[model samples]
Target: MNFALGRYFPADFPLHRLDPRAKLLGSLLIMVGVLGARDLPALGLLALGLVATAALGRLPLSLVLGGLRPFFWLFLLTFLLNAYFTPGSPGPLGTSLEGTSQGAVLTTRLALMVLTASLLTLTTSPIDLTDGIERLLKPLRKVKVPAHEVAMMMVIALRFLPLLAEEAERIKKAQMARGVDFEGGILKRLKNMVPILVPLFMSAFRKADLLSLAMEARCYRGGEGRTSFSELRFGLGDGLALATSGLLALVGTIW
Candidate 1:
């Protein structure tokens, strides 16, 4: 019910005031750093950086880590696969020592990656994010890339995440009220999900259809000659943020 991912949290802070382009680029840099991390120390540094960024944004710890809730299964699966299958010496409970270490490292990297991305969306508004992405891709226009359209599609997908989550939750409750048992063995649980999935897909298509109609009614056209109310300007803060992120990325790569 409390969807935090992709939903902007309004606040007056340094992170909130940062230009969207800066945030996007900075987040990407941090993600690169996360990928480059090969040891516990490197991962610790990345984790500290994320905590600091969250602090700068004045975001709640709960909100910052809340993004991981949805990816719990992913993290678990990644760890399990690595721990059970990777070649290494014996470890606790039949897991290899090397495999366990590898699993922990990989899981940490993934968590950091998710946190970085979530923080970007948490701090930046959807509109600003769209503009930022479009502008970043603007140079691709020379190569005939539909920059604006691509940006719009990405943002629209993010916006729909919470809507779909809420819709699924509502459908689940409704089905439960009608005597649908969602608890049982794996097969039974999966079978019970049929009712939920069918209606969810139907609702999604219906919403998409309605959206298309609304756009047509508004005389919607591509971003050929559109102008924005607020122009994006790179200022001192943006430069500082980019420089710091660049430094972090370099350290991650070379260290």
Candidate 2:
């Protein structure tokens, strides 16, 4: 139940001290680079850059691998489906060789994308991320867009992702204690999940209600005149991170 989905892990590393704005923009660029990569060599370079970034951030390897555990089935499914269905020369086991290659590339691309995003969240706090999003979207406010509200919604959704996973685990345990068999066919598993899903939804709603009440009690309002306690400033580390991300993107494009 030690899921790290979009959860912040604090460390005094350079990445942790970087301005959220820099990380947000830099991460976006790196993600775009990952998605735009069309060759294995470029993808390999991108993967290397990601690993180096994680090392630079002082993030634990266990945390990175554990965060990816939830997506193992997804990775497998993506590769399987593409390998079996894509148009290519037939290979061993009645699979297309080219299709399998493409599938492997795609799966790697997806894993790199997820890892990059997870790193962003692991280094940046939820509050800083929220503020960064709000500031980034401020220009849209002139068009009557609720930038602050949107950022708040995004942050809340991210903050709850891991909590929801933990809650689902707890519910599963409770159901198992009551003799609910989660094994067997897909349909049987689906049936077993009903009890867990219902209560998890209810719990989420209850938490949302309490949160609303807490906000009301504190007289909380939108970010119209809100001031931040820690001002985000672009520093040397922030510049380096952005430069590195941009360099990766450039190399990915040309390589």
Reference-based TM-score of each model: 0.94, 0.95
Model 1, stretches more than 4 Å misplaced? none
Model 1: per-residue Cα lDDT over 66-105, one tens digit each? 7688788899999999999999899999999999999999
The residue-by-residue lDDT of candidate 2 on 85-130, one tens digit each, is 9988999787899889999989988898888888888999999999
Residue 130, candidate 1: how far off, in angstroms?
A: 0.9
Residue-level lDDT for 51 in candidate 2: 84
Q: Looking at model 1, report the run of 10 residues with the lowest lDDT sum.
A: 246-255
Q: Distance (Å) between predicted and true CA of 245, model 2?
A: 0.2
Task: Let me know the TM-score candidate 1 reaches against the reference structure.
Answer: 0.94
Residue 48 lDDT in model 2? 91
